[model samples]
Target: MRKPVLTIFYQYNPWQSTIGGIQSLINTFIKFAPDTFSIRLVGTGADNGQVVGQWHESELLGRPIQFFPLFTLLDDNVRKLVPTTVRYTAALLSKTLQSDFMHFHRIEPTLAARGWLGDKTLFVHNDIPQQMSSAKGAKTILWQQFPQLYFWLERQLMEQFDQVLSCNSASTKFYQQNYPSMVNRIMDVRNAVDTSCFKPLAPGPYQQAKQQLLDRLRLKPSTRLLLFAGRLHPQKDPLLLLRALAATPPESDIHLLVAGDGDLKSEVEQAIEQHNISSRVTLLGAVPKEEMVTLYQVSDVFVLSSRYEGLPIAMLESLACGTPVVTTDCGQGPSLLTSESGLVVSQREPQSLAQALVTVVDNPQRFTPEACMQAVSPHSAQHVVEPIYNSMLQRWHVSQANS
Candidate 1:
């Protein structure tokens, strides 16, 4: 018998470096979903302006990936006007018309191709209106001018999906409130981590790893390491993290490890110089995913000062690595964090974040490594993927029966 096929549509290439939470979620799904389901990943080649109408084949995590690129014929300005989902809809549908199940990374694509989305599942990674409103420049102006129309379209698009999966309760609640008639279709399917790769290191190995990281950074043994891993953009608010570091006393043995890069790189450098905390902060720009596990294990605490989020994978990985967190109440941070795992401050202020960092590091015993690891056990790939796969199977079976 032939295996059932699962086709995934995403905006960006998931194989690229510095991937976000959505990519991580897709990667987990591709890695753990049963062999009975043959998966095909369709995405644009916008990263390199590769040719359109071509299917690129690659293997990730021992699974075959067939990527379909779109928008190659359009200019940058024209592509920007059309959302990635809309621009790539025809290409995606052309390649996956016979798929047993179609999975969308965002709602726009599902909306653009709704007529052909038989047995489809849409994943909501963030609050759509909030994300648009947070944009700067021309995009912000566009959103301001047509807010109602945009939301109406978003709601209509979302309602068409057979099942809507949200990465956090905040997103699920937003959708539920906006489309009350389709409340039953929305479900919270939290993002997950590779627990085997992120788990706490053994005592001897842990000490060795810590020493190696410290030596490489030329830091003292007594210095406390705080890690921030994400894009250095307005939404992530890396500037806020820098200001918080400035608020910390110079004598404090705390040091920060910035593990990603973005448009605000220069600003982050300037802030370090302006605050005179150059020695306390190290910007390791765009560290590979493989190295993140070590960084998490070596850090005293993982910190995130994002203005908003939809369940950050960095925070989840930090907890899985047995490191406590100090983050602003963004996305699922408020609910995912507890006294046993870490601290969640109310505001995204420098002083509040600094205080929380001090409290977490000063009283490290309060958040045990075991407790931190246990807190994220429910988000492990093994635990989260089974239910999602089962849901897909049930949906496919129902569709078959109806057919």
Candidate 2:
């Protein structure tokens, strides 16, 4: 029997090295489905002078990946006036329809409108703009600006798909509540993490680099470190973390390592200074990927004070490093920690977070490094994700035979 062609559509190329949730999906697909399925990944190429064309191809981790350079020089005004980007995307979908099955990454209205879904089409739900806006109702002016037409179309096309996979339990709840017709087909398929490079670090060059970072940042030996990594954006709520840290005494022997960068870097820096914790907070900027494993190994605790998430990989990596986590009850990922793994605080509340941090530090025995590692077994790519990929292919074959 011939292996089925599994086509995956992504808005951005997986090689861009941007910290994104979609990258996790691409990595999981390539890692788990390479043998049973012939993978074809399609994405938008660089923003160059070219209009639209199949610009490049590369063998990424044993998968055939194609990038289409669509509207190279895309000015906001020009893109708004012309639907050339969508037109080109439709063409790409048209070409990829020969695949036995299709899996659309996110609920993009333009892609959904193109109607390239096969008998075994799968919709992976990451976030819902409509539900988000409704939840924030009066307080969210920014969320209200979301494209109404696009959101409505997303809801409409969701019902047209054959199967749906949610990133977590919360996402499943949201979809079931809003799009009941598709609930029967929906299943919880949490994001998987790659353990090849994210395991616990041993003493070596990585250890030397960790010491250098500590010395350069003037982090005292007695200082207990708490890390907040990922984008420095409004959604990430770094300001709240600063407030939580500020509630402690000036004499407190604690340090917060802010890793990653984004639009709110200045705002976060200003907030740190405003709290008079400049000496205690270290903005490591963007640390190289090779150094991250070592940093996680040496860290005392991992924390993510985000207002939203879809199973963040950093949290899982922290667990892989056997580092205990303390995160906000932002989404399904944090809730997975359970009482035995780490502390989960109230969302958007710095005071609550401050209390939780104090508790975590005061009773360090509550967090066992062994437990952290044990909690992450279900997310391992080999054990958890490979079966999901195989089942997806099997379902496609069964559907094709019935037709």
Ten-residue segment with the worst summed lDDT in candidate 1? 73-82
Q: How many pairs of residues collide in model 2?
A: 0
Off by over 4 Å in 2: 46-52, 62-64, 69-98, 109-113, 117-131, 134-143, 146-151, 202-209, 286-288, 399-403
Tens digits of per-residue lDDT for model 2, 1-403:
7777776665554544444555555766775675767776655555543335554556666666544544343321112333434554655554534356666765542354355546445545434542365453332223345557755766666766767777767677777788777778887776677777667655585456557767877776666778887767656678889999898665657688988776678888889878888988888775655667777777777888876666777888888787788887766666679665688987567788877776666666788767888888788778767777767767868877987
lDDT of 1 by residue, 290-392 (tens): 8988999989999988766778888889999999999887677668887989999887789999999988888878988999988898899989888888877
Q: How many residue pairs clash in each candidate?
A: 0, 0
lDDT score for candidate 2 against the true structure: 0.67
What Cα-based lDDT does every candidate model obtain?
A: 0.78, 0.67
Question: RMSD, model 2, all Cα superposed?
Answer: 4.4
